[model samples]
Target: MTATGTGTTSTLHADAVRTLTDWRPADQDQEQLRLDYLAHLAEQPEGVYRSCLPAHLTASAAVIDPAAGRVLLTLHPKVGMWLQMGGHCEPGDADLASAALREAVEESGIPDLTLLRENGAPVPAKLDRHQVRCTGKDRPENTHLDVQYIALAPAGAQALISEESLDLRWFDFDRLPELTDHSVRDLVARARRLTA
Candidate 1:
């Protein structure tokens, strides 16, 4: 599980490689993306870290209020888009699931959000690879190979906006804002099926 070049090791990076290697993709497209992620990890020891040039692995969660048939989204300041809650894996993160959950809770400010589980552990509901300007306004774009999950918000849960977001709001599953892209919608659809 040690990355070849870095000499230094990261448990998060090792966990990511193991998790993706063990995951069973639902379709051919997912299968292809899974392989691509493994390849990235194989070549770059820092692939799970944001500092990895060009591309890196990110963990995210779609916060779903299943009782209300709503999904909580953040108005990302950088992209100016309504998107899921997540970010780069941190050093403290024990695994991809923990990273995704930490991002979800921190971004949403909803303390009790719980990840939907599979086999008694939080598993990714979907995977998305997208271009982003994560470093700064002046920096070139990077690719985020996002491992997406679903989190269930407690009844009457209220979200506070973090500095990372311009705003935070919950929208009906059928009425997500126009600012969102197909990736968000697709993630929501997969979350919906998981919750159902």
Candidate 2:
């Protein structure tokens, strides 16, 4: 499907728009957010793929261990907060789910993390809208419309800190770090239901 937005003509982005437009969110709030994202993408071609604008699409994973008792988190260097591992979508990404999985694997250094999906597309466990500082000076401040998913880590999957992270650790659901944000907990709750 060709996109009717104002941005570069990329079929990859058209696919992303189509995927988001077709997804069924779990609740009314999510439904609204999904529709908003779809509309934004339909109007702004770069809206679905750009990381430098005021509002952009991002994908993240709440990395759940195989036993589902612990979640892997990364201390964001720029934000100075403990958060889930995720980042902006890239051109090579086939879809948003693949983008989320790619970010999870890259940041976790875990080779075999498994993403949850429905009907062959990555199904987000939850959606979050939050403001983020542009980590790079070239990009302006932006709002991240994040597609959050639950990724199952292989047993004994060890997390290593990448250049983007100050630390990486697994926390029990009941005892996340003191610096972890409230949204992390919400992501966990949604993820638990998905994994259960």
Candidate 3:
């Protein structure tokens, strides 16, 4: 596996391109989004970073505790929604999966999380495109082209809330809070299937 958050912007950019190129989409919509992400990276070489405009690539992960039959979610302060842990591709992020794992660790405060892999590789389980004021409330809304992954956390793991989140909690697979949107629900379902 590629080391997380240990490369330069140029290297991270290249890895992003290669990752999207090699990723297999589960459906036509995801395929199109994959193509669109590739196009964005081509046009804007720095699209993997948060500084990119209009749209940028972001990495996220759903933290699943299969033994406990639950998933960890954060109540985002900015979006005011219960969602997975993720953010911009930082300079230290060696690859998309590493970035996702880093975000998962930081957001969930779980030190021993491992990514759910396919064919022994940490690949994305889903892709989502959404608009957000990621920069700040004063800044214009930008599109987040998110690459989502599933991470496995140790059972009975204790979590600590970070500044980015309003609250953090675990929810049963079938009993997610109403604050979560369809996208999050979809991610949870996908994570569940991956673990099961």
Best by lDDT: 1
TM-score-wise, the better of 1 and 3 is 1
Q: Could you give me the TM-score of model 3 versus the true structure?
A: 0.93
* Model 2 lDDT at residue 46: 73
lDDT of each: 0.90, 0.80, 0.89
Instruction: Give stretches of model 3 more than 4 Å off.
Output: 1-9
Candidate 3 positional error at 81, Å? 0.7
Q: What lDDT is obtained when candidate 1 is compared to the true structure?
A: 0.90
Question: Candidate 1: deviation at residue 165, Å?
Answer: 0.9
Q: What's the true lDDT of residue 184 in model 3? A: 97
Model 3 residue 136 CA deviation in Å: 1.9
Residues 1-196, candidate 1: write the lDDT tens digits: 4433244557788888898998897999999999999999988878898888999999999999998889999998888899999998876787899989999999999999999988887888879999888998899988999999899999779999989899999999989999999999999988888787
Give lDDT tens digits, candidate 2, residues 59-121. 899898847488999999888888998998887776777889999999999989889878775
- What is candidate 2's local distance difference test score? 0.80
Supply the global lDDT for candidate 3. Answer: 0.89
Model 3, span 38-65: residue lDDT tens: 9998888677888878899999999999
Superposed model 2: Cα runs more than 4 Å off: 1-8, 135-140
TM-score of 1: 0.94
Angstrom error of the Cα, residue 97, model 2: value is 1.0
